[model samples]
Target: MAVAPLFGTVTLPSAHAQPEPPGEVVLSFPTVGVSPRLELGNNVASEVNLPLPAGMSAVRLRGVIRDQANLGAGFLEVTDDNGTFLGMVEIPPRSARPAPLPFDIDISGARPKGSSLPLQFLVRTNDIPADCGPAQQLVVTDLAAVYSGDEPSPVTIATFFPPVLQRVTVVAPTDADPSEQQAVLTLVSTLTRLYNPQPVQVRVISSPRGTAPPPTGPMARAVVVERGSAGLAVEEAGNPGAFLRVSGRGDELTAQISLLDNELQSLAQVTRARVDQSASHQLPTGDTLTFSQLNLEGRAGVLRRSTFNIGVDRAALGGGRIAGVGVNLLADYTPVAGGDAAALTVRAHDTVVYTAPLNASGRVDATFDVPSQALTQRVALDFEITYTPGQECGPLIAPMEFAVDPRSTLQLVRGGPPLGGFGALPSEFSPRFYVAMDGSGQEQLGHAAAVVAAVSRATSTPMTPQVVDVKAAAEADSGALIVANSVAVEQTSLNPPIGGNRSAIDVGLPQNLRADIADGLGSIQVFADPPRDRTVVLVTTTDAWTLVDPLFGYLDGLAGGWNDLRGDVLAAGAAGTPVDLTVRAGGSDPFEPPNVVEHRAPWLGIGIGIGLAVVAVCTATVGLLLWRRRRTDAAERP
Candidate 1:
């Protein structure tokens, strides 16, 4: 009939039908806040602070998923802080716990115009499915855009996360140049502030001969020299070296000298200044002198490049008969056009008095002394001038005082103290003359030291001025105890053959050691003078007694494993007797060995023999004793 419908086996629809999958993911509305601010040249910008609401959150995604069926194929793409695609995770089918979408973005190295990323997701599975209606397609237009600007873009303040700590120590040699010294100081300061590594204190001490007392009287004065006058082609003659001096007629005053290299860099600093004293007592008597060694590293430059101003204590030096005083400059250089013409002018107050042109070869046979007994009974010398290049003559600036009275006994002596010739001082430079206790006077000459402390109050360098007395218990035993302070013992003697004649050797160990000492000779004892000192102690012993050795190895065998002997030995010692031993079972079954039959297990044999014998003896002894005691008691009772 109609293809004979089969009615024998009929199947009906299930209780419920599978719902249709979502069509596409879409946002109800996409809105972007763009302020009225436009950067230069059609640039659009906005200042925005993004934050999530208490109960709501936003997620970013890439590559929209459209499903005509279940619409559950959407997945979220995660990116780094720079908006670079990192990874992606699938959107689970309609489920209770939905996977969270990632929102972080990284935009580093993007194109100049910038790009916007629109995201869409199918909401087939979730507590509240996303409405993917036809009008819900999300279009986030111009999400982010940046324009390159002429000025560097402003950098946002990053989180101030601190770094891990580290320690470092730096050592600077005394012979380093000034620039290097400065660099070291800077590095030390920076490290201290950054990590606070304990800094070691450095003390630089120098002793040069002579003395320099602070200038006295209103007329007493000092001279200061600075790098001056460059741009000349003169050669240094005699190279007497540069020096600073302060003196009066007859006797020379003492001062310190610092040498400079060709780069105008200070090379070495010397403090021995010996100025001649027995000179004429005229208006311009040269007396005190301070010398500083310098090596002008050959560098083409004009003088007067360096500048300095002499400091003066007017009230202390501008009184009495010190009136018109002058300062003299000296240089030792070969005379060329600009080099030979270089001469230093002496200036008193604002007036130039003495002018001495450097010699043709830059040698100084005589001092360009100035007279200063005019202005204020006591003169105050304060002047400034440039030293043109090429005049690397002897003593740069020599400030001297002259007097009319020839009966003056106040002679300028080089600083008498051991560390007097450092820089400017209060006294004058005297000849190397000393009054010997014997009826004889000889000249005493030596480099006096100059000590300057450049410590800051905030420095953390140790400043413990006194030696601290420490009190601690020692590790040595009493009664002729022997202790060793970082001493090592010879191993060969301690490890002779087992029964070999062990010779007694003095060692670092306890005096009353259990190991017999061979005639008080072979024994190595660590003797502690006070008997309570715990200094390092080294003991020499036979190799057979070591942990690796058989007899002694058991000691380590009991502790699971052998480790370094950083600590004291804890095993009990036997006085001429065998030491007790402890052991651990080796096999896995502990109760039985793998092949216990053909070869009886060691522990099994022990257990069998002792266990059966104990039973047999106990049973027999009890029966016999009971029988005898019963017989005696029965007889007595009856």
Candidate 2:
């Protein structure tokens, strides 16, 4: 007998069968690093890069505006950086209960320079009120662009990637060999780095040996990886779109993937291309670097209070730990009025390092050393200026202007504790690192790819990985990413933060306390190998390998991936959220159960004493209540 399907499908009426209109895609300003709420003064302006996707047309710019200044007669103007007017809206006076005024301005006439639309927002007040406060401002917020169009299909290698992409799927054979797997991992890292801050989802899927990959959504692209004669080609796929096919054997496969990293990839404006060989250009490294060398721009502002950060990354020192840091700051500011006062303060990692008065010279040249305790993987040098206006606010008064020159110098002295944990990653593994996988084959390779890709996203520099055996990676003096099960990890000389067999595992907790967990657990731990003087990141599971999936899921969910991870280890069970375990120094004993039990003995005795006292008090109260009830019953009977 034939069985019906579990669910039934209903047909819609003919009226409802009409084709639906094209849907709108909303792109928020914050996605491109533009703050939704922009505070502007009389002549101040803010600019944002609105990425224009291929085949999509912008409908309008929509946002809310708050006119806090009560400027009854002014307009908020929108213009291109080149002074091309696009649109404008008049500012209205503030209401008694000021509500957010909504604006929907049509920007159909706006044209993009290259692939992005550079739009500037500014308020121009022709006359300033005599009684206005010094903090008068205009706030613009909740900004977003509405686009309506279908994504265009890519016909060449250059056009294959759009300005905005939701996801990219890398498809490989179900039984992919070592080379093909490595190529897949390389592609994941390369694409993730290229689309930094965009949060593009790069994933992998396995298909049959000689079959086509499953279809993808309009906003997503799929690239098929295979083992064959070397070449990178764009093949036509029916229905939705086309898929990129990259194929080669061993090293050739890797070289083909490297094409994505080349600036000349735009020259491959055809359907097919072959890369004989490819090489990556290494960035120049040294002890001292100027702000401009690190791609930092000078900050300039006209306000009572202004602050900016000068970020120095450890990776900029070529995978070395920071021993000392020195900065020669060059700044310029408007001279304080006769009655007004101003001061400049500098901080490293939020700790005040230097403070000085703003002199009449209108220039500051100060050199200072960063504190040792303030050092981290990424050091932030904050420069702040506070200006107090002495006179009543008026149009005739000059606004405070301050700036930090791009020529400011920073000197880094390398040599300190080889930082352990996630903070040391990406930087410590820079230039090149080794990858060692156990006998698990494709599954292990997939995990390695996830870890590699997550680490690559944390830095601007590209990291090269050489696949080697476990023994080679263990003995090498360079950083390594090791993916293995409990058995494999125990064999390596490298020590992980957490260790033991499947039946029982030693968990490193704070305050010299260690717990023995018998349940199946998976963990990702980072530890410094004192012998090799290198950092090692280990991914292992006590029992089931599937438990490791959640650990990676936790990492992927974070906006910063591995960069956001803290502590030394991340452990999880068969189900539930992963726990961030930090192993503190001076612990009673890391892996010794007897020491941990002894340490807890005092607390255990105190807890027993409290419980016994509570029980005795309850018993006495019950006995007295029963005796009183019996005496009252006897008196009533008489």
Candidate 3:
């Protein structure tokens, strides 16, 4: 057989023969939707054919080759349908083929989809592209029939391209309903082949009606885009899968089936009414009334005690015909002590509403049907009764209770005293007074005295007992035996010694006293009045002649201060005076001694005068005598 320059010019090993037996290239499908590859012994060549889908105008061929034996070398070059040269490559030899040599070529312009054409890979002797003139053609095959051609006789060898699977594109729902049995099975199977453990995501979609095969069961309502070979086979192999079963509410199903990128659990939402009320009302007597606002159903009742008057807030009373609101009075007002037990008539306005017994510790629920026709404004109830010691009053502390009906205005009369309960005394009526008396005997006791007297009279029915005493002083001079007495009266006047008793003559005595006896009389008066009760009297007697010898004996010291010298009685033994005839005639012994005024005065005067005269005479006489004697003595001395 003859050979032409093709494939690549084959290179011979420096240590080996010129021609090497033709090597085989095998192509196979590894993954759908993926480029196909060619298998060469222990090495893999990348996919040589990238099929363009139906409308695609271009295809790309790419692959890799391992020299394997260090001794073998070859060249690679491609040619189009017309046999025009396009591009070339040199496959270098390695000590051990180094590694795989990779190559890619644009086959788009060379061939279009659905076109049966011829393409060639020529292998030759040189490892360099330019050294290929003598190169031999390794293969020449039709591209469309590349998959299954028989052997040809020639000095060189060639083989058809290997078979690769076609990938089908489709759309499917990411979140397929679980009840879709067939759809679920088909999806699961396809994913299982592609991924060993089965991928978490699988698309199951519905095919269009009539345009594709009818599904066996319910068709998948959702679109399924399958990618793997098994998926395409399973899909294309059977009637396009069934529509998915709808579950529950379509809305709920749609919501649950809608896929989200993040993993989450499905949730639902749903609506419901509730009531609340509980409280206890404590009565003054230590009892409690408990009730619920919600459970009242229709109407309720309550009991109260003691006639202080139980007040109800008119606004809070619900609008309803209280069947005869009447108050019941319990004798002695003793509550039914421990548990709920007591009865009373409750009145709403004039109508007798409810008559129910109250529990000692519990409350009664009195309910009345309030008709639509009933008035719903302010209403009051008044109870009339005679004075009773104690009574259990209905709901009210007092007999009269003012309550307004429901939906009406409230009439509120303030409960207690207007003063808000404060008690205090004013200043004008406070307790206090003033008093006085006239001290001068003139009794000019003025308007002030009258006022005092009026006050005393007003405050007293009888006179209060009072005592008064007076001390009077007397003085007699020269010849008069008259007593000049100063009286100090003591009384409990506001101003004591000066007034009150001054004009009132409690007692009177002779205002004159004999000079000699006046002292004794003064002493008697002093002793007569007690010091704590009354003032004392003092009398002084005087005579005109007492001055005649007042300075005798150099005054003998003053009469009362330093010395106690007595003077001869004169003027009939008066304190100061000349001798009287009666006293002179009786002689000193019997007549109480006559005054020595004349002798005392003259003697003192004469003695003074004579002593002065004697001194003068003696002084002159001695001079005369001394003169004579000196004269005599001088004569004797000579």
Question: lDDT winner among the candidates?
Answer: 2
On the 0 to 100 scale, the lDDT of residue 583 in model 1 is 12
All candidates in order of TM-score, best leading? 2, 3, 1
lDDT (10s digit) by residue, model 3, range 1-638: 01124432222223342342233222222321222332221111112433322122333344555433322455455555565553445555445344444444444446532423345555544433221122222221212211222222111000000122222122323332222322233223222222221111222234332233333321122223322211111223222342222122222222222221011111211000011121112221211111121111112211222212223321123321122222222222233444333454544544555465433433333444222112112223332212221344332332212221232222222121111000000000011111111222221111112112221212101111111112111111101011112232232211111111211211111111111111111100111112222111111112221222322212222222101212212111123222211101111111122243222232222221132121222234334434654555566684
| Cα lDDT, model 2, residue 173 | 88
Return the lDDT, model 1, position 36.
Answer: 16
Worst 10 residues of 2 by lDDT: 1-10
Residue by residue across 1-638, what tens digits does model 2's lDDT show? 11112221112123232443567677776554345677776667878778777778666776777656645556677777887676676665454424666666656567778868878878776656433355557887788777778877888887787777778888888877768877887788888887776677788877887677677776678899999979988878333658889999998897897788765677888888989988885654687878778766556554467777767555655546567889888888888768777889889877898999886889889999988656655767887887766787666766578878778877888775545767667777877788888866456776887888888777777777777788898889888988988888788787776777764555443322233344556878887777887788888888878868888888988866886776667777644457665453312212122233223322312221232121211234334434544655566695
lDDT of 1 by residue, 1-638 (tens): 01102211112213363332242121212112222121110011122222211111223222222222223433333333344343333443434323222121222232111123222112222222222211112112223221121211111111010111121222223332223222233333333323222221222211222322222211111122111221111112112221122222111111111111011112212222222222211121334222211111111112332112232221123112122222223334334345423444445546555455543444433333233222221233332322334444333422121111112112122111111001111111111111001101110000000000111112222111110111111211211111111111221121110111132222111111122222111111111122221111112232222211222333223321211111122121112211221111111211122242222122222221232121222234334434654555566694
Clashing pairs in 2: 512-588
Judged by whole-model lDDT over C-alpha atoms, candidate 3 comes out at 0.25
**Candidate 3 TM-score versus the reference:** 0.19
Top candidate (TM-score): 2
The better candidate by lDDT, 2 or 3, is: 2
- Local lDDT at 86 for model 3: 38
Compared with the true structure, all predictions reach lDDT values of 0.22, 0.70, 0.25
